[model samples]
Target chain A: MVVNMINRVREQRPLIHHITNAVVMNFTANGLLAFGGSPIMANAKQEVADVTRLSQGLLLNIGTLHEDQVEAMILAGKAANEIGIPLVLDPVGAPATRYRSDACQRILQEVKPTVIKGNAGELAHLVNQDVETKGVDSTGEADHEAIVRLVAEKYQTGVVCTGEKDVGCMEDEVFVNETGHPYLAQITGSGCLLGSLLTASLTVEGNPEDHLMATLSHYGRAAEEAAAHPDVEGPGTFIPRFIDALAMEVET
Target chain B: MVVNMINRVREQRPLIHHITNAVVMNFTANGLLAFGGSPIMANAKQEVADVTRLSQGLLLNIGTLHEDQVEAMILAGKAANEIGIPLVLDPVGAPATRYRSDACQRILQEVKPTVIKGNAGELAHLVNQDVETKGVDSTGEADHEAIVRLVAEKYQTGVVCTGEKDVGCMEDEVFVNETGHPYLAQITGSGCLLGSLLTASLTVEGNPEDHLMATLSHYGRAAEEAAAHPDVEGPGTFIPRFIDALAMEVET
Candidate 1:
């Protein structure tokens, strides 16, 4: 099947609602826009549910977790579940703090997320595998496959573990795409941007696994192209070209 | 007098404490790093004052204003003032919401900021000028110089109004730099990044007027160079190159 997944996203224009952290909001929104998806960020406890109701997908990223934001996310997550729209959870730095851990647990318990996208360390934490993370950056090693599979079965949701290799698991079926650049991790919010891209892709009518792998392949291809650009000197120079590459047609 | 201001920033490496908005945190941090200045963002009310004490300057951005964030900003602003460190305020989207208007008022009333940075419309609101703003983008026109002057005099602080022409006012003295590209406004947080740049620049010894003008000129030069790059296609393509140009030593 010719699955032009991202192009379909451009045509369908799925609006993805994000209740993410402070650091990556602009990058995440811009990346989604570059990849042909609409992004909306609302963070008030009073109107989060209303915002989630209008969006095609909801992304709850617990990076800069605040008490007020957690409350808002719970409301939005519940609304997304009630509306029958797909929800994606990025439990960023869940192991770093008690509040983050509790917030993630509350989300996993109270919300029925369609997909969970995170780093190996974050997913490993979700599946009870020990992996050390400092702040939001994952620094420890883990069996990504085991973590994704275990978390996939436990949460009954698609799981994605992103690193040098990107792995996605949906129940018994697992997929891996190893086409990314090292530079993706060098800059902030690449993983969060991927969560947004995956959420936007999942909103399209297709197999979640297919969409996951496609999004990974597409993002990796874009990163590879951006890193290879002559004008890109370092991480700072690579970001804009990466966004441009996302907007361009690359072989996925 | 020969003034290599940015190189001085690299040599000094001021640790700038930011209690700014959510959307532009990553970009602002990365932009500062690329420009060879250190940026630290702390949000919790408990640690903001402590964090501000360690830094050379504090930035209070009311873009993604929250009640919790306002409290943190107030505490940090007060600490910076007491420590005799400079504070830069970006009253982002002040006219859009009543909460934001009130928040800006509270900061202005309670905090003794050294410099205030914003666009014509955003600055106009502070001096009680009726200029309409949509979200954060300035839609209406005003006397940029007049706005800067009024705000600077009223607050007894240096003021910068950024647009096609960046106007800086310190009491009776005024400086204007006409070197920035239009693409600077196309991306999110360019103004906020400018606020960070101005804050970093102000920390360097010499005239705040000279530093403000030099920083605007440098940023504008970077934007012009980035926009003129062969690889740039649009705003997405413009951002990375702009950052790279910030890293590159362009003549101010």
Candidate 2:
């Protein structure tokens, strides 16, 4: 099933529209391309609606929040909704500052994302639970299943709470994926890139639940493979290898 | 001299305040860290001045310019000027949009950057010279030395116009560095990363001319080394190796 979903992405060549943060634009774009999806990053409010309308999926990441980009995300998200294409939200750094938190809340209330993905802290904060977040990384542990259920029910969307083990929940069903590596935490944008992969995965025709699980598993396994490279001494070397691994045709 | 300058960056551990676009923030930050400089990326207008005041150097990149970030860059640039720390301006995509051109002009006029870095197209646009630019890349080649001299003299700032050969000029003298690889162009943020390296290099005590040359040389040599790695099949694999090479303590 995972292999079919992965092959679907490579066959369809879906164009994913991303209104993501500046910190991970290049990385996310490269990752999307490596995973066999086309990426178009357009964030100006003047053009986001048009851009989102042309894409198969929309990804809204608030990693580096700015007032204008927040507005642009809303515009693009609504456009994607109107077109009935999948939209993914990555509430990056939601617990780091009020500005980010408020922006994520606003986007959530307005667009109603198809899938909402983040680390434990961001997902917990979205559901009004207390969790410690440093910058964009979650520093506190939460009951991933409970938090995912709360968010999935509240937002009426699929929820992916990622950490050492990734949990994907939709309605009452939960899927746990334990395929990634700790080295992913040391690199910036690992979480952000996962959001991009989720956006691409949703464009494929399949069970939304299975699609989300496949994305999490595929991405995590890729990181594990990259980390096992003999030359990957640290996070710096692991990054490119991860990209190459993402591009590989994995036999599931 | 290059080795001494590089050692200075490792010793001083300058905290570089970056008000750069979002497209390359992670790569730029990682590159700064790899080159032995501390990086702080803050662009919110509310706190840019305070952040700039606390740093050893400033980098203003207009790669992903938005209205609010342009204001924040001006704020941070002025604050850096007040403290008399070295400031580097990367006029990314200056020739691509009028808004970017105006923003670059405003920052150049007000901040008086210690070092101005851009490709031939950007420098030509800054000087009102006709040069073809495809996005951020210079599509046409002109007399790079003359353009660098014109920009350096007009702005009363050192200028580095990068291309196949990087030309650095301070008033009447021009230095050319032919040290980079063409593979560098295939990757995103390579030019933006160079601006980060230049900012870190400028914080070290040295002749401004030699500092610019040393930065270009160090970065180019790193790219060359990364490209030569047996595992580096293309730009995808080259990225991580490049980061690792940058982290290596080269004896210059």
Candidate 3:
């Protein structure tokens, strides 16, 4: 199924709209391009709506939310929702600050995404529960079953909680996939790429669960391959090769 | 003088403050890193002054300009000038739009940069004349002696115009460098990197004319080397090799 989905994405290259933070924009663009998708980053409030109107999917990442950027995100999200394009929300650092948490909630309410993907603490914050979020990174594993159940029930949409293990849950069904390297945590924008991967997978698969599964398996397999190469040192070298692996996957 | 300036930049490794557009921000960062300088980019109106105060040199690029970005650029330029950081201006598309032309004039009038870099049309526009600008690219030769003299007299600052042949001029002096591949223009942020390189060079060479000559020579030499390699086919392969050459230049 994962291979089929990968092939599908390569065949049908979808344009994904991103209004993400500045820190990880380049990594996100390269990741999307490697996975057989195009990325269009538009931040101005005047043009984001127009850009989103023409894109296949919209990914809203609130990693570095400011007054102007937040306003632009809301405008883009509402536009995406109106146009029936799939919206994926990455509520980065939600529990760490009141401004961030409030902004995340506002985007969630306004966008009404088909899928909400975040770390354990971010997901916990969304459900109105207290969780420790260390900056933008997740420190601990989530109570996968309990949190997923609560989130899926409340939002009536697919909820994805990512860590060492990844859990994707709908209202009644849940799927767990444990296949990623600890190296992912050492680098910035790994989760951002994961969000972009999910968007790319959804361009191929209609079912949200199928989309999540394909994305997880694709990322897991590539990480395993990239880790096997001893010369691939640290996060910097690991990144370019991972993209090469994704491209190789497309060919085979 | 240009060769000695290049050596100094590799030795000093200054921090460059870049108030640039979103599309070329990451490329500019990577280019500076490869050349042994640090790049700091922040566009918030409130924080631009503070960031500029800490930088060794400042680069202003208007590749993807808007109202807010133009405001931030003006603020940052003024701050850089006040702090005595060498400022290099790349008037990306001043001849393409009224807003851009007016903003460029406003920035020059207020900030009073040490160096002004642009193509023929942009230089003409700065001197209160109408000239054809082919999109973001230049329509005339960058090494034209007449244009260089005209720009230097009008702006009362050092001027560098880049194309197949790059020209550096200040008042009565002019230097022409004819090297670099056409492939350099195929990439998205090549000119932005040029702005960054000029900033780094000026940190080592106090003279804007010498700084411009040094940067253009190094860039042309590196691109020539990259093009000589058998595997260097397109912009993708050229970028990594360009970085490798810059790094090697530092080490050698």
Candidate 4:
């Protein structure tokens, strides 16, 4: 399954537009590149629509929410939607502030993304539920199936709750993907890269549910492979090996 | 060496203050987390100085330069310099515009950086040379030897030029650390991670030259290891494994 999508990406080399925060901008770009996808990191409102329209998929992450970036996400997301491109929304730190919650809600209402990727805690807050979130990081494990279900139903979109065990839920069906390592949580943009991976997978599968499943499985399997190597001791070394594994795994 | 740094970070988790661009901010933070360093992504002018004082290392990235962020970088970089904390600069998109080059020069003048990280093109521009930089990304190889001595001599700061081959250079000494797959270039924040790695390494090493050599060598070697793995296929898979490799390479 991973090989199939990897073949598609290598053959098609889709362009992904990201209107994300400044924090993970470089990592997100590199993640897409490792996945055999072209990345365009554009945030200015003037260029968002143009860049999004030209790309194959759109990823909107509100990690560092600001008035200008929020507007750009909306404009670019709308353009991507109208052009039949896949849209992935990463509502980062949504529950931390009213401003964030409102901005995320507005984007949800306006963009109507095909997939919404967030930590279980972030998902709970996005749907107006209570959650114990520390700063922007999730406090619970990735195996919380109930929270994933609630978020999927509330948003009417695919919900991916990533942690110790990642779950991808769409309405009634849920896929429990247990592929990643514990080291993933130690890093910041692990979730953001998952978003980029989902976008890359969607470029091939074109099904939000299947795309999410394949990505989580692919990421987890790669993490498992890395963990098997005693030399892969921590996150620093794990990062480069993870990319190397990605390049090979995609090709089957 | 990479494993030692990873163990050190885990043993003594340091808070890294970053006044970076909105882009790549999430990836930087995540890279820090993967390495066991806490990242604080704040760029507000009012609080930047206060925030820098508490950080073990300060990262200044001008990927998406703005007037307000420029001011904050100066304020934070100066404070970091005065407090004897290690300061690293990622001159993102320098020479793209007059505003960027001017701002970079200003920051360099106001605060003496412990180390500077960027591509060959960016480093060339930072030192006021004509390198034909394609936007923020480098078109040349990481070890373009042409400008290494020039950059080191002009800046009076250690420089890590990353690409297919990573080069760490100081005023009199230069080290060519080659490790990393070609696929790394496809990803965006791979360079940003090196910047964060430099910060994490500085928190422990204290010497700018040592930090640059350790970071470039460890990152380079890990990339080599990551590329040797069979299951690692693309960027998606490469990420986790790469982090694992860095964790193992940086010892406590």
Best by lDDT: 2
Per-candidate alpha-carbon RMSD to the true structure: 6.5, 6.3, 6.6, 8.3
TM-score comparison, 3 vs 4, better candidate: 3
Judge candidate 3 against the unseen true structure and give its global Cα lDDT, from 0 to 1. 0.76
TM-score of chain A of each: 0.96, 0.97, 0.94, 0.92
True contacts kept of each: 0.28, 0.25, 0.00, 0.53
By DockQ, rank the candidates, best first.
4, 2, 1, 3
Q: Is 2 or 3 the stronger prediction by TM-score?
A: 3
Q: What is the TM-score of chain B in candidate 2?
A: 0.98
Clashing pairs in 1: B180-B220
Candidate 4: tens digits of C-alpha lDDT, residues B1-252: 555555776777777888776656666676667556777676556556766776789998887788888888999898998999888898888878888889998888898887888888888886566766677887854336657677777877777777667777776777787666776777667787788878878888544566567667777666667667786788776765666566553434
Best-performing candidate as measured by DockQ: 4
Question: What would the per-residue lDDT of candidate 2 be over residues A1-252, giving only the tens digit for each residue?
Answer: 899888899999899999887778888899989998999999799999999988999999876667788899999999999999999999876775566677788887789799899889889988899886544567687888889998998899999999888998876789999999986765667888999888899999879889888888889889999999898965679888899999989686
For residue B61, give model 1's deviation from the true position in Å. 2.1
| lDDT assessment of candidate 1 | 0.85
Query: Residue-wise lDDT of candidate 2 within B137-218, one digit each (tens)?
Result: 8989799988988888789899999999999997567899999898899999999989989988888876878888888998
Stretches > 4 Å off in candidate 4: A1-6, A97-99, A141-143, A205-207, A227-234, A249-252, B1-17, B21-31, B42-65, B70-252
Q: Give iRMSD, candidate 4.
A: 5.0
The DockQ figures for the candidates are 0.18, 0.19, 0.09, 0.25
